[model samples]
Target: MTSQTTLIVASPSAAGRHYECRRHVTCAMDDAWWKSSRHRMSQVIKCRFLPPARRKRLAAAGTEYWKSQARKYCDFCKCWLADNKISVSFHENGKRHKENVKKHISQLSKRSAKEFKQKEKLDDEMKKMEKAAMAAYLKDIQNNADLTSQELNDILSNGEGSSKLVLVPAPEKVPVWHEVKSESGNYYWNTETNETTWDCPEVYLSLAEQEEQKLKKQENEKAKERLKQEQQKDVYKEVNARLAREKMKEKAVKQPELIKNKSTYTSTFGPAERATKPYGSWTPVVNKPQEKVDLQLPKSSKEPIPVPVVYEPETPRIEFNEKKVESLGEGPVEFKKRKFNNHIKRNMRQKTDDD
Candidate 1:
């Protein structure tokens, strides 16, 4: 029997050289070769495979590093990469990748919508709770002695109700009337007649209330009349002021020199009055001349009057030919026959009868 030892490669294959082996034997678990081989395999596996989370972190770090380097291409894959670090890989064109991206977008949209709905629901619930709390507080207050049920009902339902305590005072007793004259120095009370010329009650209202009512009534009436008068005065003043301003403007526009001496009554009134009058005084009048003495008839001439040669106006001649007459164009034409003269008388027959 021959004894053999196993060898394990620790580092990367050094200087590619083959060694002669006496036997191909498996090493025991406690052997140094097995331990070294296991350690080396663990390291190789760790370098070959990475967890998903760690891979993502490493990829993110690599993107950041690439961004800092400002490289246009990936160092590992030797492919073009965007500055945003979106993978320009064959996976991006895969159906599964596209589906995953769409699913992520849909999930984000659904999450936002759910959050918004939840906020609205929370606001509505808060408002309802506030209303309920207010109602309970109001009920509690109404249950206390400070406010009555009727008052609370009135406030809630907007209904009018009488108060428990009356505020108005009772009517006062009627005062005694006396008829005492101002001239009488002594005051007298009459029992049977009860009729006098003075000291009668003018009004039956309480002193203070009567004075206030009278003053208010008088003030109201006076204010109404004053307002009416003020309105009328304002209207008249506005009309007069407008007319005056218009007249001043017209004077300024038409006669600027009159505006300089406008303070003088002559300048203000003279031109205005002159312009208002008729222009007959500024017009010139013409007189007609008398005719000479050709009105008398001339004396008769001794020689026979020669025939007066008068040239008469010529009349327009019109010739009518019956053969040229035509019928009306639109309707059917109708013709009427004419009767001709046939009988003739001779003047020689009367001389033969007398012979």
Candidate 2:
């Protein structure tokens, strides 16, 4: 059984006519089909910016979504979409995207309200602290006013009917206080209590305070006298120092002349034994006349001076025994020395019988 195959070519007239494939055109235009086609064609991009995915996603990946050449990103849905207007409109019209936008707005409002409450609470606490500080300051001012009134009463004293005598009780062994003035302020010292203060004491003219004031006046006078004495002593010290410096200058000037007058050579001492020391620790040198040695010549006959004869020891000789010597050729053999070669060739040695 043999099978036959046939090929048929279209005519020129049929080629000129265009043939079109037709589907159900009405079905393609239907809203349901369009929705299905849109859904099938469009890609669903998962948002890395979402709260659940943000921890695991890289910031660099999220940055790519907002790039000019990339797809469109929706701020409310926190997702990327196709860059076309149609895709954007479709996404915006969706129920899920609308709900996400509403939820985002609510979250923003809640966060703002929480921050405002926190700021208001902090302001209230600050106001309370400021009020407490102001109260303390006012109390201190009231105490200072009372002290001022008492001071005024003491300063304006009348004979017999004095307000100081009436208000202040009779003196009863109060602590002695001394006032010292300084550039910063005046400070008061209580000798008995050993306390110090910048403010004046309440009992200013007590018997003890009066005695201390008297002592302070005496001490100031004595201090003035001591200061005068110290100034005199300093003047004397400066004069003494100047006189000493002048004396040293004169001594230094005369030192070279004294050294020149001293003789360098002496008969009693050799030059080495009588070496001169430095000026700081110099010893006085005594001048002595040099002594001359008289040489007595042999009177008539000249006698030859005898020369001493000295003998030196000879060095010991070392000899080897003839019996200990073996054959002359038995010793280490001497090889001819060779000149050094600049290039040393290290090649693989040919295998020999020994190898």
Candidate 3:
């Protein structure tokens, strides 16, 4: 208990009146914390006073139990009938409801609406344009018919005046209709119809020039091949120049002018010769047997003494015993050492000296 938070709890008394019972509670929780949340409520319950009821009364006419539900209904939108704050606000803010409001406002006075006036003006203009276009179209057809009649009368007058002059002159002779043949068989033109016919000739000298055109195309193709070869040669030369530059770089790296060659860049061996090659051709030779020298030791008159057998000694066994080892006295192996009696002997000598 380390707080001073007071809470009101309603308790039913025998007098049939609910008392405003307040309790001074102490807790780690803050007094100003939210009273509706679960954590603060649990903390309030642990104070040992009678807890507030699980279901508390909100209000006599709260938002959930409002008798004036008509207040939530929008008067402007008659069909919009939501009975809560969130739904009513959403419906009022919605697009269809906003459009309905606009329509209602526009219908109040058509003359006040600029859009309606503009639409009426557009309709009137369209009708006037259609009528003008129809009248112009009818006038154009009448004018075209009158022009045709005038042209017909003029042609008749001109023909009457030039009839003798046009017929009296002798007609010039055209080249005789000769049948022409080529590698692609024979074909020709008709003089009477002035169209190409399989039976007659038309100079239009294209037949004679086809072979020359084919030869020219062949020459052009050969020229293109020669140009391509020249391009390939140029490319090869560029690649060779690049290779030479790379070789010069490698030579400079390998044999830098520490001892500058007064001679040329060419080595003693040709460019194709391997740098790691031997001076001459190697010959395969047979391996000769080696003669070993005999060791001549001095022989004595006495017989040679026999050597003695060298014995390999065995390591001693380290024994272990199950009995408890005494802290005093000597033991069998080197590891089992006894404690010295020097302290006891020194104490005895001190006692005897005191006596």
Candidate 4:
């Protein structure tokens, strides 16, 4: 079927169209609705567009005279007579034809009403088109060549009516609000309430509105806090400035007073007591602050140590009964061993303090 081909005849008024048909196009066969000569004859005569004279000529389907009329006719309705057919006797007395006739009349009335509305719409559209064309023409004339205001006015008055050109004052544009959804879900500005509200029931709307207002209130609070901070800073600056001025005034007053009341002697106290302190002043030595020091130690402790002591003397002791030299015989004097001379010095200082 795909490889099979057919030729479709084209006309000057219509394009060539390919349609699926069981019979060949050249074969003298009828497969489509309203293609029969009788149906075509009947429909042509019934068409509302035909004149009475033409209807009468095409009404006689079997007659040779009826065959001379134009062959082309397009059927708007797709009714097939197989289910739609009726015996002449039944058709004359049938409920089907009666029902169809009533339906047709009803449909005709509805179509007439629709056509009237469409005609009004088309008339309005044509008027708008004319207005746009006139505007474009006037704009072109104004741009391409120079014309005086009077000439322009005269052209406007004569060329086309400007009273209607006042433009239906451009239909008052209504704000068309659209819904903006986010991760938080649906929300939009309500023009009537003049606030943002949620897409919910009347019961929840107030709660949603409260939430929204709460957010706005929080923002307002933050702004108020910032304003308060700025005011505080300004107040602090003003206070500091005032304090500095007061201190300067007090100092100025004191300067003059001090100058006027200056002492004949520069000393603020009696001469003996007014003497300056010496570089070194006395204080309990324990109370004075001490400097820090670092003392390095041996890296390792050598634990094994020997004691140092001298038990044996180099000279022999003299016996009491033994004969001695004349100087030594006077007395055997004993002497005490001292480790260091600084200890003796410390003892002497203590004695002096005691005295």
Number of backbone-clashing residue pairs for each candidate, in the order shown: 0, 0, 1, 0
lDDT per residue (tens digit) for residues 1-355 in model 3: 3655444333222211122223444666545544444443343332222211311332322311111123344556776464567887889899988988898887877656777899999788667655655554565567685765677789888886355644576774544343446444564534455343344334533455656657988999999999998986775565556557658877888785655655545556656756675687788999999998878978799998899999999999999879886786676655756787644764453545554
lDDT per residue (tens digit) for residues 14-117 in model 4 = 22211112222223333553256554333331111222333344445332222221222223222322222243344436676667777788999999999999
Query: Sorted on lDDT, highest at the top, how do the candidates line up?
Result: 2, 3, 1, 4
The best candidate in terms of lDDT: 2
Candidate 1 displacement at residue 168 in angstroms: 64
Output the number of the TM-score-best candidate: 2
Candidate 2: stretches off by over 4 Å: 1-69, 145-355
lDDT of the candidates, in the order given: 0.51, 0.58, 0.55, 0.51
Error of 1 at 216 (Å): 83
| Candidate 1 lDDT by residue in tens digits, 243-271 | 57658877778787766768755545344
lDDT for position 38 in model 2? 42
TM-score rank order: 2, 3, 4, 1
Each candidate's root-mean-square deviation in Å? 44.6, 38.3, 43.7, 41.4
The total of clashing pairs for model 2 equals: 0
Q: Give candidate 3 misplaced runs (Cα > 4 Å).
A: 1-185, 189-196, 199-205, 257-355
Candidate 1: residue 99 lDDT (0-100): 75
lDDT of 3 at 83: 59
Question: TM-scores across all candidates?
Answer: 0.18, 0.22, 0.20, 0.19
Q: What lDDT is reached at residue 306 by model 1?
A: 89
